[model samples]
Target chain A: MIQKGMSVIVKTVTKITLGFILLYAVYISLNGHTGPGGGFAGGVIVALSFVHIMLVFGKEMALKRLRSYVLRGLTCAGALIFLYAATVKFSGGCVPFGAFLEKSVSCRLFNSEITLPFCEMLIIGAGLFAIFVALVLLSKSDRYDSE
Target chain B: MIEIHLILLFMIAAAIVAVEARDLLSSVVAIGSVGIGLSLAFLILKAPDLAIMQLVVEIMSLVILVRATMRQDLPFSMSGRWVFNTFSTVLFMCVFLGAAYIALKNIPLGGGDFGIASGVYLREAIPATGAKNVVAAITSNYRLMDTLGEVAAIFTAVVGVMAIARRVGRPR
Candidate 1:
């Protein structure tokens, strides 16, 4: 039988690792427009972090941490957010809407650096949330089989 | 040139492994890896968007194939007559050689001044649409209807998955 103390240590390590991964995911998502990484890359990384957490701490624990309904809601919300953003442009008499969302800002949040386009954040969020939902569903199914 | 030759060698190795492997799961994984490697080559060749699309589609295909295979036993390999094998090899070689010749001779060397129009549009797309990613600009602006259709297809796929998962009986 596995010792309680060893399991605790493992759990602690896993939590730290997951925390770092989440931070990195956010960094990648935000900096995607200016670098090699973007929505898809960041989203995959986020999903991988969840997968790691699930593997380390059983599906039940992971599910408790990240509820299925919340994930589903986030997935739908992301898509809706993206569509809403597009529609906002569409209603402005802009032909082939979502045309003006990509402009580079003169100054971004941190200092005077040029900020990436606004739609990038929506794309990143949508992609990340979608993958998160898929991973949750897949992990839950695996858990169901195990049970 | 070296990368191309390396990719060709890798492709040949994957093909042989896929043919000779006894386990269907291993074969599928091997094919999937080959698809990933091919997509990597496409990225190295300056087609990042195509590479991303190829990777996503290939992974989805692999997932679907694995799920399907999980429902049944893999078929046993069958040996063919020597003449048939010979003919198949010859036909494959001829096709490969023909394709290689055409690719080497006809295809453009690089993207070649294709960014000018896109750059001009990029400058305007951001101010007009408020989106930052140029790719997103092209996707939602130049191809809004197409983007909508793609989203609809994805929604349909999600519904299909839900329906299949909710089915009463497991497939035999």
Candidate 2:
């Protein structure tokens, strides 16, 4: 089993800042359609936040919290979500993509005039997080065996 | 403009340092700095969306690099073939860069070719998609196929990583 986390100071700081990091990631993902950030950016942020948990709390802790299957599911789900959102004709075939939402002037009530959903960002973030975690876990196992 | 120039020079220096660093960790850190500098340059150039993406990508990649390289005390291997490989790579890079420079120097930048497309996007974006941010609109609305394709590619790569890692790590 992989043991040994970092020092107390590092752990304390990670505990404090980890939640904020995740929250910020969510904000970025949700606001992607209307702001400077987007699905790619938010997804990466979310992955990094999980990585931070691993760095501070040890791999075992991180792995226990999240397993490989979950990530695999997430990655596939994210792609599926994107496919559904992108390929769908939207709202009973009112229009197709690349000009799909161009005619709708009334969606401003919810997204400040932004029509993009949060699903894409969430999936991208989840998939990326899972991939990073998988790689880290793999490397850790390699190190353990070598030792 | 001068600030951008200074940042670009610093980025170049950082790239050199990253390439030349003795240790893996230092090299990773240096590369991360280069990413940060590039993001700042993007911000200054009025591409805030790109800047944000750059910042997140840099940090995540840095994390991955640090994680991947932390285990071994990897010295710069002085194998005989290493020197030859390095020399050839440098030569190839120089020739490619020279060609690129010649081509870039002759091309007039502002020919107003794609402006019409961008103009249509700007005018129709808010009306159609409700995206206040034009960049966001372009991503999810204007050119969704590109985004879908890119995301699919990344997902495939990640799945591959998961599979390889699992195969390597499992106990026989």
Candidate 3:
């Protein structure tokens, strides 16, 4: 169908737009330390890409391709990973969590001076996955009444 | 200075339009645009972290509101009389004038002593945390507890969502 072809074109354009947004989100997340963005901003940027994709391709397709359960698992896994890192740091005399990682050299991962990036990556990943799952679920449930 | 005023005016207009718009969806979009504008204003005020946070939170809130409101039929018209509109407009103007007066009278023109400690924190965070990003340093180190609490809050939100989405007497 000609309509189907138009939809395909629209989908392709949306995908390209989302790809660019994803790159910017990663850039913002990584550069958050020195600049204005961080895990939250980066995560939102990435989530917006999924939103665009869903809007263009339809929720059913997105649910099939992006798997709500997988996103839910990713959200939990990312949060657990971040919490584990914080807990380890907290138990290592880093009172409050990430203290050793922050004002001291004794808690550096791999004994390197660059643990913030790794920690940020964890936060960013967790935030992104959590937000994505929430959006997907909310969108899907809004339209179709799943009993 | 002129640009800031222009943007501020635009923000006010957009907000009013959002409140008065007949279409719920259009109002939501307008509110989202106002949020973006507010974020840009924060950025211009040299609060990048706050700007980013505001943007993200606003987007999330908008999505949630849109989803919730989509199932309901929103009223398209105001239910009050001309007197109500006039009174509201006068009250808004008075509030705006009061705020402008306070901002002009209390806030300083340049950087003040408030930023000195933050600067010191940034200087110390680099060698202390082995992190090149000062913002990261502040978030992960100096305010570690706050960040942890935020993470916990996010986790709680996830749990809440799952609880809401679960069906009654549904098998796990």
DockQ preference between candidates 1 and 3, better one: 3
Residues B39-129 of candidate 1: C-alpha lDDT, one tens digit per residue = 8788878767557656755665565455423333335547758788889999999999999998888755545454666667767876765
Give per-residue CA lDDT, model 2, range A56-116, as digits (tens): 7886787788876776676676666556555552342233442645434322322322223
Clashing pairs in 2: A43-A125, A101-B128, A102-B128, A113-B130, A114-B130
**Model 3 interface CAPRI class:** acceptable
List interface RMSDs for the candidates, in order: 6.4, 2.4, 3.8
Per-residue lDDT of B90 in model 1 = 100
Alpha-carbon deviation at B78 in model 1, angstroms:
7.0
- Name the candidate that leads on lDDT: 2
For each candidate in turn, the TM-score is 0.59, 0.83, 0.69
Better of 2 and 3 by TM-score: 2
- Model 3 segments beyond 4 Å from truth? A1-6, A17-20, A91-147, B56-68, B71-116, B166-172
User: What overall lDDT goes with each candidate model?
Assistant: 0.55, 0.73, 0.65
True contacts kept of each: 0.03, 0.73, 0.37
